[model samples]
Target: AQSVAQPEDQVNVAEGNPLTVKCTYSVSGNPYLFWYVQYPNRGLQFLLKYITGDNLVKGSYGFEAEFNKSQTSFHLKKPSALVSDSALYFCAAVDNYGQNFVFGPGTRLSVLP
Candidate 1:
């Protein structure tokens, strides 16, 4: 069984400051991790993915994530926070054998100007 976890329910950041959303996972084999963002009443948009490669993977909108195999963690990060960057973020993991993707409880980001 594979599972994803987002420790924080919400993250608040000031505009122009850096922001981070933590995520962790449990899987039987090598994990395929992904990050997605969702807006109100809209479908989730893919932000980034870590299939294989460098430990640090960059993604859309200046977002990046670090994959730590030892810790089974993938934490999302942004260099600068924007008021418009406020949204719900989700961390997901694909089952090693199965094709299903299990998503973590979303983390809402609130950027205050």
Candidate 2:
């Protein structure tokens, strides 16, 4: 079985400050981790992914993620946050079979100016 979790239901950050959204996963075999963001009434937008190679993976919108195999964690980070960055963040992981993709409950990020 594969599952993903976002312990924080909401994250608040000041503009231009660093931000992080934590994510953890439990899966068999090598996990394919991904992060996505969703705006109001908008679909999920791809942010970053971790498949292999480097533990750190950079993605769109100046966002990056660090994959920790030992901890089974893939946390999303940004050097500086923006008001427009406020949205719903989701963490997902693909199962070993790659047929099922488990998604987290989601975390709402609020970037205040």
Best by lDDT: 2
Clashes of 1: 0
Structural similarity to truth (TM-score) of each candidate: 0.96, 0.97
Ten contiguous residues minimizing lDDT sum, candidate 1 = 93-102
lDDT of 1 by residue, 1-113 (tens): 56799999999999999999999998878889999999999999999999988999999999999999989999999999999999999999996675778999999999999
Provide the clash count, candidate 2: 0
Listed per model in order, the count of residue pairs whose N, CA or C atoms clash below 3 Å is 0, 0
lDDT of 2 by residue, 5-104 (tens): 9999999999999999999999889999999999999999999999999999999999999999999999999999999999999999996578678999
Model 2: weakest 10-residue lDDT segment is 93-102
| Model 1 lDDT, residue 70, Cα | 89
